[model samples]
Target chain A: MKTTIHLKLYAGLQKYASASDDNHPIETGDSVREVLNRLGVPPDKPLLVFINGNRSKATSLLQGEELVKVFPPMRGG
Target chain B: MNSFIGKMLNVDLTSGKIETVSIPTEWAEKYTGQKGLGTRILMEDLDPKTDPLSPQNKIVMTSSIMAGTIVSCSAKLAIATKSPQTGTITDGSIGGHAGAELKYAGYDAICISGKAEELSYLYLDPDKAEIRSAAELKGVGTFETEIRIKEMAGDPQVKVLANGPAGENQVLFSCISTERYRQLGRGGIGAVMGSKNLKAVAIRGWLDVHVPDMKECLKVAKELHAADKIDDAEYEIYTDGTPILVDFSQESGLLPTDNFQEGTFEGFEKINSASMKEVRAAKKACFSCAIACGNYLKGSKSDVEGPEYETIALCGSSIRNDSRDRIIEINSICDDVGLDTISAGAVIAYMMEMTEKGLHDFGIRFGETEKAVEMVRKIAFKEGVGAEGAMGTKKLADKYGGAEFAMHVKGMEIPGYDPRGSWAMGLAYVSAPRGGCHMSAYPIEAEAWGDLDPYTYEGKADLVVGLQNSQFAKFSMGVCDFWPVASDNLAKLYSVTYGGKWTAEEVDIIGERIFNLQRIFNIMAGFDGGDDKLPGRFHQENLKSGPPKDISMPEEAFMKSMQEYYRLRGWDDKGKPTLEKLKALGVEDRFVQQYETYLATS
Candidate 1:
């Protein structure tokens, strides 16, 4: 079954996502990496990825209705 | 005397005596300038085991050979002292008109020793020096102190380095504020200044730096300017300042959130560069900085200088709060209180974690902006529980039973990035001479740049070591890191300005030597391989998000990487420089023998 994953950017990464891109969705079957690849987001970017409030890697298979968030390099003191 | 002012001003606060001493030509040639020269002076004069806050612990403020010259991004100064936080050599750099003024005032450095019996401010003009009573300036914040000093000096051109209540209270992470917002922020340098009972230092000058080859130097400056303009990605940094990293860090999941329990924040957009531009009243510039990154943001209540990357991350995302206005207010509070924002935020975050775990009664709920502001003020004034908070993160965590979650390296609070997420930064923090610093070796650039895999730990060791070496060189030269000039370009600039044949390789060698020297200092201070470690949380807690989900940094792999790093650095198994390596670097046998004796005992 096909699952839809929601992607959100935090802190400085919001520059890459405008109002039009809010709550942007990407499709994947199971793995998070496949979803990122399908969404055209480069995995090489300094992205901290979270799946459903827990830290997960791109290789981790996704469950349906997972809340996925990506962030850039933090500048906070 | 071609590049240097040839003299150093020694101020004895105990006796109110001020003397000008000629700098030895041999010392200048051996140590170069700024951090290098400052370290050499400290090693020669002060005992290695001297108490950091004692009157005997000298505060060496020095400018580089390039400073005050018509060189790009030379408006930098180094404040070197035994760190109260780390108990090791610490040097913090600040960018402003002050370093230039000092160089123009015909001095390469100012050596301050001993403590004043009463509060005082030093006004150093080009020809005269005075230690005046600072009765009126007592209890004043850095911003107010700067304004008052400018007014009192009767010269608006004077550059003032001032401390706030945090310093007066001897907060372990208190910073010296210069050019209003720019800080010599790490290692409690302000506490050292405060211990001296020095309220402020105001300097003014009209002399110029005599460049050996002005035409060639100017050509290089023009090239640097051109390069800055053409590089669209880097050039944008000039417009937005460091807040630009807010979005980048947030997206990368590197932004520390909820006391670094998670890597991502929910409300990053409200605190990023776009929001900053929306809130700022005007853009500001430091002395001779081509890229004016300083933002003067006006909130409803006050007009503050910034909510830079560290401030925004620590005050904003780290708490799961995204209000730019609140962040700006807190940033202003830190500036006014003369506190380091990074440490302040870390302490608050530690408190939040404690509160969440039922460890203590802090009354600080996560995302409570008002409480955050209140706590910042209280910490500054050392009021009630704020006293513990002002002592810094490690101390606060120790007061409660939260050593595992203190989020500090070498006693100083860690910056915004959670090391478990980024291995290179973790290494940088673990091995950072001044403790838990991002700027010492910002591996984030290498980690983020190009089509390389950011999540993989492959090839990070070499990049981190190289960057650390280069950053040491930058610190030695006393140049602001914002300048895009590479080491090669800098070598050419140095060659032209100093009338010396400085190749890029020679520059790298100097950097390596400085890095090793710093390592030796830390080693001599009793920091061993055991101290080169992360907090328990980083090693044990698994990352819940990102590409490396549920993967905690394996200590074995990390230790191996460190060993490889040491080997690459020409050090022994215990992370000390080998005899052959020391001899090759031209380090005298006396230092080597002393270090060996210390190592054997430790």
Candidate 2:
């Protein structure tokens, strides 16, 4: 069965895709790494991934209906 | 003498004496400059147990060896004093032209002691230093005080550091405002100034700072700027300033909502970077800074330099008030009245919780935006309940019986980061020489924002120690925290400015030494392992939302981490630095022997 996730990109990472793509199709067992690969994130670029507002490893499997967020490595304050 | 002016100004208000003293070469070599040098000066000038508000207390203002140079972000001014709020050795870094101007004025530092006979301001130019009456400018807001001082000096370029009504009232959390925007923002430095009847200081100078190699300095500065242009973190800072943290904090369950009852704010979208960008008026920067991180905003009813991330977190999410415009207005009032926004928000939020719980009736409720603004004003003017509120969260909680939820580590209020989500941040806050300061060591960068697991206590102690050491050294060197220079680069900068062959290892040692020096001063002031603790609420209560939902800082784990942190720093279980560690850091023999005897007897 197919599933979809809400994807958000921030801090100059939106150039790769729209800032918020409310419904992005994914497989039931697709990993964050797979999603990033499909989204055209450069393989060597470092990113902070979050699934449902929790810090997630890129290789962690994602469930459908998750709010997946990606950000460029950023720090201030 | 390459970058330092090699002259120090000693101002004794009681005697009306102003003397130019040569800075000791030994002190310069040992402490470097800025916070480190200022800390050393304070150590020698005032007894640690002296009342912070009394005339015996001294305020040491020092510039780094790099100030007044073409170095990027090298214009920070360090102000060190015993904090009236925390009674700890506290030093704040003020950014603007003040430090650079002082260097240009042929002085590396100013040590101000003794109470003035009356209200006064200091005026310093190339060859003149005078204590002038500020009785006419009494009770003026910091913004107007700056304007009036400039008029008095007849130079628009004159940099002014002034305190407002909050300061004049001796508010425990009052801040010293500079350039009418930046601040010596924490630990009640302004209160000390007010206690001394010092309302403001105006400085102007045009002399060229001597550099060992002007050519090399320019090349290094250009390279640093070029690198900053392409860096993603710097770009985010340059573009979004600090409100970008709102997005990350909200996402990571670390936005500090409702007095840290919860870590995430549902109304975060109303005050996040996107919301702030809507009202963006302009961007500003400190002198010689490449990263222009200051966001000047024009809200619907108010205009201000920022409601920076800390202000937004404390005044917006933490208070449950999400109106961006009101936050900006609150920021303006705090800046104008010379109040520390972090502590002000902490006070208001604590009172809100107190009132809600029926512990005490502060007449303020959660998300009462208008009431919150009024409280800020009242706190500044010492009106109504704000008179008590100006005493800060710790004392309020003490009297009102809410010590469990006071949100202060020492007597000083906690900063924006809620520690339950990032355990190491708790360690950093508790172990900070000053109280609950985020700038002491930002472990959240590694945890909430980076790759480290935010939930675990493992390895946090080492991370906190490393960051603290590096940050302390950088502050001493007068480098801006935002620059993120590596040890090698920092060593190179030092070598160029101080005319020496400095190594990265040596630079790291300087950081360690500065950290130890502050710790020693605090220990001497009577702070110990007992004082290195978090508010009970963090341990007893769980955040109710986001990823950190149902999570509390485990008391056992936290204590373990604290002990580990002390061990890593070569401090005893009681959190006093060991004699061997002090000696290794090249601390003077007197301090080493004093600690040696204390440790032996204890």
* After superposition, candidate 2 runs with Cα above 4 Å error: A1-5, A15-18, A23-43, A59-65, B224-234, B594-602
Taking the tens digit of each residue's C-alpha lDDT, what string does model 1 give over B71-103?
A: 767768888899997887998888878888888
Measured on C-alpha atoms, candidate 1 has an lDDT of 0.77
- What lDDT tens digits, residue by residue, belong to model 2 across residues B1-602? 35866788999998989999888888878888998899988887577779999998998999989998878888888899999999999999888889998988878999999999989999988779999999998899999999999998888999899989888899999998997779785889889999999999888888878788889877876776675553344256776878988988888788888898988888998998889988898889898887778899998888998878999999999999989999999999999999999999999999999999999999999999999999999998889998989999998877888998899989989888888888999999998899989987988888887778889999999999998888888889999887878777888888788777888888888889988988888887777899999999999999888778899999998999989999999999989898889998899998777656655655
TM-score of each prediction: 0.88, 0.96
Q: Judged by DockQ cut-offs, is candidate 1 incorrect, acceptable, medium or high?
A: incorrect
Candidate 1, what DockQ? 0.11
Best-performing candidate as measured by TM-score: 2
